[model samples]
Target: MALSRYDGCGETKLDCVSPGGVCFDPRFVGGDGVTFYFHGRKDQDFCLVSDTNLHINAHFIGKRNPNLKRDFTWVQSLGIMFDNHKILVGAQKTSKWNDNVDHVVMSFDNTTISLPPNEGSKWNSLVMPSVTVTRTSNTNGVMVEVANNFKVIATVVPITAEDSRVHNYNITDEDCFAHLEIGFKFYNLTDIVDGVLGQTYRRDYVSKTKVNVPMPVMGGQQRFSTSSIFATDCSASRFGLNTNRRDGVAEYPILHCSSGMKGSGVVCKK
Candidate 1:
């Protein structure tokens, strides 16, 4: 690794290029330090990561551009299934942008999670003590932790007029295209973990994305699409189904929730 010049602190900042981050039009930085794009279909679910005990799926929302072959998509929300429990987090929809108003929504096991609008304040699941959600800011930022499993830092944001103009997103006054910008830190991913980002963590994994391009778009939209936000039925899915037990019975449960942020804001389950 090369050292940064005194004023050139390129490595100090966090961007979509972080190996464990997902942001903006759904760009992903895999564990191998390679960046790629996966523009899944609008209003569909795609698996982001999958392992023996953890499965993460993202629901996409987007619009079509006349000139572009694909829909300009963003991860509208996330569904996480772990240790027989479920977590959901995402940005709420708004006709206009307002930082003063909270846009982040969260839920655990079908119950809404509401953290006070104060930085560092936190809420832990009563029945599931290993899980906790903390606010990183007064609004729009949060960190979810599952003890030894993983930690996720996420922020709610909207695509601005400038962003739409530059990228031709066609974002209209009816919606500001609010979505999530999230980062992951894994404490226990197996070598065989599989997904767009998960496969890069494998010990023997090799990147298939070309190195010459500035934006390397990953292929295989079909390989990662799930039936729904909480369905772990993607082709590459490895959540819980592979586990073996004394009775040889695997309990794979899926928790479904209504999309969109609503109802008295987010309130954590007591």
Candidate 2:
């Protein structure tokens, strides 16, 4: 390593290239998997040039033409992982209007936030949910990053008894309430080291948290849309070398409520 002086500061050897760029006044920024603003001339005051060309992070640059399918245009899922040197990005198909990529511009060995959950509290519970993150250090591997606010929709069947003599001989006037909450405590990928489990594995983090999502109320017992949070079995487990067999079970976590009259003991199907 050689020490190079910058702006009069004593020369300091660098172990790694940080986010922006390194020496030679690069008119382009090409770290973290995405290259932006590159000038054709290499030495002619690279950093000072204006109107530089920006390239897409991966091969999906330019207009959508031949290779990628139309579904790729609407990236529904996105994830960023930081490991040894490269940044890994994962994008899925979406039906949203943004036709752009849901997952883009991720770097290896860098700790970036995961994708947001499906549909939940867009402001409080869903946006920017945090998860325990881990990424593969190798080149072009599955990137695993911490994702917060991961949520899934489940069906809740209301077990109600029909009677004509409960309140008004036909129907009641009081509004029934059912408190529902769902959560999952997933182990951090960083805890597994050299096949040994670390103490941090015991700590569980809430990937997603949802509150009374106001299920539609109808006559007697009815079917309602309930929001829940649980650990999902991701298929990318083999890439990052996972340990500690924790079943990514999405079946039962625990359902709780405040009042118990409009509904009874709730049972989840699939």
* Predicted candidate 2 versus true structure: per-residue lDDT over 53-130, tens digit per residue: 100121111122244232111111122221212223433222221312232223323445343433221221233234
How far in Å is the alpha carbon of 169 misplaced in model 1? 1.3
Candidate 1: segments with Cα more than 4 A from true spot: 1-15, 241-270
Poorest lDDT segment (10 consecutive residues) of candidate 1: 248-257
Question: What lDDT score belongs to each candidate, Candidate 1 first?
Answer: 0.76, 0.20
Q: Candidate 2: lDDT of 206? A: 18
Candidate 1 C-alpha RMSD relative to the actual structure: 11.0
Residue 160 alpha-carbon offset, candidate 2, angstroms: 36
Candidate 1 per-residue C-alpha lDDT over 76-152 given as tens digits, one digit per residue, 9 for 90 to 100:
89999998899999989999999988999899999999988987788999998999898877899888889877777
Error of 2 at 196 (Å): 26
The C-alpha local distance difference test score for the whole of candidate 1 amounts to 0.76
Which regions of candidate 2 are displaced past 4 Å?
1-79, 90-208, 214-270
Q: Backbone clashes per model, in order?
A: 5, 11
